[model samples]
Structures are given as C-alpha cells and as structure tokens.
Target: MLKLFRSAASIAALILGIAGVFLVLYAWRLPPFTGTVQTTDNAYVRGQVTIISPQLAGYLAEVAVQDFQHVKAGQVLVKIDDRIFEQKLQQAKATLASQQAALANSEQKRRSDEARIASSKAQVDSAKAALTAAEANWKRIEPLLERGVTTQSQADQARASLDQATAALHQADAAEEVARQDLTSTLVNRQSLEAAVQSAEAAVHLAEIDLQNTRIVAPQDGRLGEVGARVGQYVAAGTQLMALVPEKVWVIANFKETQLAGMKVGQPVTFTVDALQHAELTGHIERFSPAAGSEFSVLRADNATGNFTKVAQRVPVRIAIDPNQPLAERLAPGMSVIVSADTSTAASDVPATGTAPGATPPAQVSEQ
Candidate 1:
C-alpha cells in the first residue's frame, strides 16, 4: 500500500509539471501558442508643441494668460509696451502726409510753369512781328536815301530801330527757352515727389506691422504652458514666452524590423497607456518611417570599423489614435504606451512595404 501511494503522488507531480510548461509557452506566445498580433513596448504619445516667442523687443505691459490655460486662435497672450510703436506709426503717417503735400505743391508749380511758357511764347510771336516791320522800314529807308528822297539821319534812325528790334527778339527767345526749361524741371521734380510718397507709404506699412507684432497672439487654438513673461519684464526678439500644446496628437511605435513584414498602413491597432492604468485604446497604422532608428541617431555605429554583432533594428511606425474616446482627451505628449498591431485582418491586396501609396515623404521622423 505504501508503494502504490508513492507511485500515485509521482504521477500527479509529473502531470502538474507538464501543465506548467504549457502555461509558460502560452503566456509568451511561443511555438504552438503564437499569435497574429505583433506588440512592442517601445511606443509613446506625441503632439505638436509650439514654442511661443516675441518677434520684437519690448517691455511686457500685460500677461493675459495663466499657466496651462486654454486659449483660442488669435487670442492675445501677451501685450508689450506699445507706446513706442504707436509713436513710430504716427511718425510714418506724418512723413507720408508731408510727401503727399510736396507732390501736390509740385503739381501747382507745374501748372504755373506751363502758364509762364505760354506767355513767353506769345511774347516771342510779338517780337517776330516787330522785327518784320523793322526790316521793311529799313529797306524802304535805304532805297529812299540812295535816291536822295530821305536824309542820312532818317536812314540812321531806321537802322537803330532795326538793331533794337533784333536785340528784343533775342531776349524774348531767351526768356521762352528759360520758361520751357522751368517746366521740364517741374515735371521731373513731380516724379521725384511721387516716388517719395510711395516710399513713405511703405514705411507706414512697416510701422503698422511692427505695432501688430507688439501684441503677441496665439497662432492656433491650444493650451498654453507656464508664462515666462511678467508685467514690466523686458523681452527681446525670439524670446520664448511660453509653449502651446495643440489638441491633435498621435502615437509612435518602434517595432522590430522583423515584425514589419506583415504590417501595413490602415491596420487595426490597440495601445495601453501606462499613465491611465493601462487602459486600452483603439488606433490604426498611419505611416512608416523611411529608415531605421539607427540612421537618425547623432552617432551611428560603423560595422566595418568595429566588431560586428547583429542586432535587431527598430523601425518607427506612426499610429493614429481614434477620436471620441473618453480617455483620449486625457492623453498628452511624452506618455509611455504599449502598442499592438492586428495584422491578421490586413487585406491581402495591401502591400506590406510600410509606405502608403501617393503619400509625400515627411520632412523628419520622430524617434520617440
């Protein structure tokens, strides 16, 4: 009876050992217990975080937002001392007005010069008529003096009148030429004045732009981080005032290269957020990185120079988180998550090349 009892106990122990081994295999999904879902712990939540900064230098007049405050697009976030900017705008306007006045004055001068030219032309016409009459009188007097019908004194008087008329005509011609030159100069001066007006107008526009820059506004609807600016604090151009976190976010999963053989865009995905008590969320495969993770590193390993040991390379896969989930709003950038892709349901027609058709290449790939 003792031997029989020992045999039964040994048999039960062996059966239990076999069951434990199966359980371990099933948990690890190895051999007969393999699954179609590919999973990786190297994943994180990411969003576009915008750094807020000023484009100009000024003392802070007002900080309109608190830390982590929700803001709307174009909402004023900070107000710089705008007194100087206002003054500058006014100065530019004054300059523009002065230029315009100069242009108008030039127009009036142009009209006056035209009138003077017309009057000089009329005078030239009168001078020409007088010279013609003087020439006729001189010719008649010379003939009479030769025939002794007129005295030498009469001839001398006629010659003197002709000489005076010639001198007068020359003076009138000179005056007319001076008047025409004056008109040309006036027209040229008007062009310069018009150019000056345009230049002043441009200056006014630049001043207005600077004034607008004094009021730093939100570029989009988002939540602002801590405000680094305070009342009366002087800040220069490009000084970071705060950070803006947008509402749109997604997940990045770094999977082993071997796992990418079955993965494709639009494949169903599920991820568990570590921050939210491992709550599972649904998503889909959005895109694949163009290169492996090592290619983006600041210092890359050179296999030719060093002892080569083969290591599995990680490829970043972008996952789009589904909207309207209650926990999705709570998700923030930089949160750790575990991602799994269900490749079993992937369409057979879809190529597993990891890139979508007709998609533009991204400028940069995020490793995290």
Candidate 2:
C-alpha cells in the first residue's frame, strides 16, 4: 500500500505542474494560446505642426498673443511695420489716377482731331468749287484773248488764279490727311495709357496684399507654440515667427509584420496614454502604411550583402481617436502610448496578404 500511494502522489504532482505551465502560456498568449488581439507599445500621438513665417520683411511692431495661447482663425498674432506698404499703396493709386487722366486727355485729343478733319474736308470742298470756277473763267478768257476780246494781262491773271485754286486744293487734302494721322496717333497713345492704367491698378492690388500681410494672423484655429517676435525686432521674409499646433491629432502604432495578418482598417482599437496617467482611450484603425517602417529608414540595410538573419519589420498603423473623449483631448503629438487592436471583429480591408511589400519575410509572431 505504501508503494502504491507513493506512485499516485508522484502522478498527481506531475499533472498539476503541467496544468500550471499551460496556464502561464495561455496568460501570455504564447503559441496555441494566441488569440485575435494584437498589441504594441510602439505608438505615439501625432499632429500637423505648422511653422508660421513672415511673407515680407519688416520690424515687429506688436506681439498680440503670448506663448501657448489658444487662437481662432484670422486672429492677429503679430504686427509688422506697415507704413511703407501704406505709402506704396497710395503711390500706386496716384499713378493709376494720372494714367486715367492721360487716357481721358487722349480721348479729348481724338475728338479735336475729328473736328479738325471735318474742317479740312469742308475747306477741300470749297477749294474744289473755286477751282471749277477758275478753270471755266480761264477757258473763257483764253478764247476771248485769241479773238482779241480780252487783254493779255486779264488772260494771264485767269491762268494764275486757276493755278492758285489747284494749290489750295492740294493744301486742304494734305491738312485732312494730317488730321487723320493725329487721330490715329491719339488712339494708339490711348491704348498705351490704358495699359499703364492696368499696370498701376495691379500695383495697387499688390501693395494692398503686402499691407494685409503685415498683420500676421492665425491660419486656423489652434494653439501657438511660442512668441519669437518682439517690438522693434526686424525679421526677413520666410523667417520663423512661431509654431501652430492644431487640435486634431491621431495615434500611429508600429506593429510587427506578422501581427498584421488579421489586422484591418476599421478594427476597434484601445490605447492607454503614458502622459495621461495611462488613461484608456477608444479609437479605430484608420489606415496602414503602404510600406514597412524599415523602408523609410535613412540608411536601409542590404540583407543580400550580409549573411541574412530574418527579422520581422514593423508597419505603421494610423488609428483615429473617437471624438468627445476627455482624455483624448489631452493627447498631444510625441506622447507615448500602448495600442491594442481587436482583430476578432468583422474583417474590413486588410493592408497586406502575407508579408508587406518592401518588408523582410515575417518572423514567428510573439506578443512583444
């Protein structure tokens, strides 16, 4: 009986030890114990950080907001010296007015030329009538002179009168041509004046744009990072004035390639922020990186050159945070977080079939 009891005790202890090992493996999701939940600590909040710069160079006249101050769209953040821009606008307007006046003057000159042309035409008509009368008189006088009915002097005078009438007609035609030419020149000058007016108007518009740019305003509703400008400090064009961080932010999780087999867009995700006391937040997988993280490295490895040892590559997954969450609002770019995606849900669009393109052959997946 003592030998039988010893054997039974040994069997019972062995069974208990095996059960404990299985339990530990199940808790850690190892091998056969793995499920559809994929998790990674390689996650961070991200946002569009925009750098504010000046479009024109000038001295800082005013700093309206302080560092980290929340601002609305179009709210003035800083003011540059605008006196020069204002003067330029005024000068442009004056130039525009001068060109317009010149254009008007050109119109008046055209009208005067038209009137002169009409006067010239009337003189031409008069000359034609006079020449007709003079030719008739000369013809009558020459016949009378040959018959001895008129004096030689009178015949000579009639011929001379005919010549004078012909000269006067030629002068009238020349005057009319000159008047038409003057009108043509005036019309051409008017076109040049019109172009000048357009150019001046454009200059005025540009000056107005520069003047408006003097007041640096927030491009969107966001918070300022810092105030780098001070009164009387000169800044050049494209100089960085500050940084703006919009309220919209999301999380990026770099999960191993092997873990992406069941992952898909729209999978429910939960994350805990280290900055917010590990407060849990809910989100959904928005999208996946087109290529593995290794593809984006500055110095990519050439596995073909070296002895190959297969290692799993990480693929970035973008998760969209659910709105109206109190803790989600506190999340900022660069904040670390642990993200978990529940892949058991109805599968949506998966990013990769097996190994993602540009990624190494996936290694055996184990919860990292």
Candidate 3:
C-alpha cells in the first residue's frame, strides 16, 4: 500500500508541474497563445469649457437662461442695469454734438479771419499806390521849385502829402500784421477744436462699448450650466455668472508607454462611456502628447535626484470621435471611459510619426 501511495503522489506532482509549465508558456506569449491587445480605463471625455463672466460691474437686471438650458451663439443670456450705461451714452453723444458745434463755430471764425486778412491786404495795396503817386508828385514839385517852375508852398504841400501817404502805408502794414496773427491763432484754435471732437468721438465709442457690455451674449452654441446669477444681484467686474459646455467633445486616453509601440494616428479606437449602458463609441487616434502624463503634474517626479525604479509611464493620446459615431448629443465633459486600441493593423493612411506635411515638431506647440 505504501508503494502504491508513492506512485500516485509522483503522478499527481508531475501533472501539476506540467500544467504550471503550460501556464508560464502561455503567459510568455509562446507558441499556441497570442498576446492580448493593450487596453485601459484611464480615459475621459474633454472639451473647452466657457466660463461666462461679467466684463462690467452692475446690478443684474435680468437672467434670461436657466441651468441646462440650450442657448444659441450670440443669444442674450443676461442683462445688467442699462440705465447708467444709457445715460453715459446719451451724455457722450451730447458732448460730441457740442464739440461738433464748437468746431463749426471755429470754422466760421476761420472764414471771417480770412476775409479780414484779404481786406487788410487790399488796403495795403491801395496805400502803396497812394504812396507811389505822392512821391512822384513831390519829385516833380521839388524839381519845379528848383527850376522856379513851381512855388515853395506847393512843393511843401506835396512833401506833406508824401509823409501822410507813408503814415497810411505803415498803418496798413500794422493792420495786415494783426490780421495775419489773428488768422494763425484761428488755425491753431481749429486744431484744438478738432482734437476735442475726436476726444468726444472716442468717448462716444467707449460709451457704446459699455452699453453693449450691459447685455451679455452667449459666445457659442451650448448648454448653460448652473445659473448662479439672479436679477438684482450686485456683481463686480469679472464675476462668474455661469458656464457653458459646448456640443463638440473628444476623448483623452492615457496609455502606458509600453503599450504605445503599435499606436498611431488614424488608427481606429473603441471606447465605452461610463455614463452610457450597453453602448460603445468608435473613434480614431488623433495625436499623441509630446511628453508623458507625469510631465504635466504639479509636482513632477525628479528621477535625477532620487533612486530610480523602472516605471511604465503613461502618455496622453488624443482620440477624435468619428463625427458620425460621436458620443450622445447630451453627453458632456469629464465623463469616465474605457478605451481599447487594436494593434493588428497600421494606420497607413496617416503620418503616424507626427511628421505630417506642413506639420511642425511637437516642441512648436509650446511656442504657439
């Protein structure tokens, strides 16, 4: 009976050892067993989130949209107390009108000054002509007096007339100088008036901008988030009013570096969203992050100063949803997901090496 028991024990040990060897062989990807594809649940849906904030400080007069309400781009989402803004606009317009009126008055003054200058110039010409005639008469009379052809009194009278004409010419010159100076001053004043007008115009423009700010509009077509703002709520500039989640969404998958050997852009991907039951979505690899996920961490690991251990770091891969097979229309961001990538086929249609035509190196993204 002892010999029989020993033989049975030996047979049992041999069978168990044989089974262990087969399991190791299978785990090691030996013959008769294929390697499983890389898969992970470290993925999520992501998109741009718009944070609506007030650009100007005012009391909220109206809140047009509610939480989860669909809004079209450029639709009015909120209205601030516009009375102040409207008054500012009206004052700015009035100032602009007054400035324009002043400018018109300056223009009229400029014309009047020009006319005065022209009249002064004519007077100077007339004075010059009279001086010329008086000097000619005095010369003729002086020669006549020397030749005894005219009396001394007549020559004296001609001399006095010449003197008078010279005084008149001097007065004309003084008047012309005054007119020219006045004209110069008027031109300078016109410049000041024009500047005032421009300033008023700028004020009006700023007022209009403020008025437009009173009516906040949605920037994109999306669903509204929690409506934290309410009517009569006093808010300051840059205050958060609400949020918007856009309709377009995509997946971000972090895959282990070891599993990235066969991953490439344009390769098909299958993922299941946690929010959806018994449903799956299909997409294609869009791009790969230039660095591993740890690189973006706030406190990144510094292997240079620490004892190093081999770690399978994960890299972020951007996967674009096939527009036709995108997540549900109501799906939002931050949703959890599981991703599976097939390595059996290559994406020959795309430049998986990140060297597409006209594409810059990954480092250029930081610069952009």
Candidate whose TM-score is highest: 3
In model 1, the clashing pairs are none
Provide C-alpha RMSD values for all models, in order: 4.7, 6.5, 3.8
Question: Among these predicted structures, which one has the highest lDDT?
Answer: 1
Error of 2 at 311 (Å): 3.2
Q: Which residue pairs of candidate 3 clash?
A: none
The 10-residue segment with the lowest total lDDT in model 1 = 349-358
Selected candidate, larger TM-score, 1 vs 3: 3
TM-score of 1: 0.84
Model 3 quality (TM-score): 0.87
Residue-wise C-alpha lDDT for candidate 1, range 208-292, written one tens digit per residue: 9999999999999988888898999999999999999998899999998878776777788999999999999999888888789
* lDDT-sorted candidate list, best first: 1, 2, 3
**Number of clashing pairs per prediction, in order:** 0, 0, 0
- Candidates in order, TM-scores: namely 0.84, 0.83, 0.87
Between candidates 2 and 3, the TM-score winner: 3
Residue 156, model 1, lDDT: 98
Go through the candidates in order and give each one's C-alpha lDDT. Answer: 0.90, 0.88, 0.86
- The TM-score obtained by model 2 is 0.83
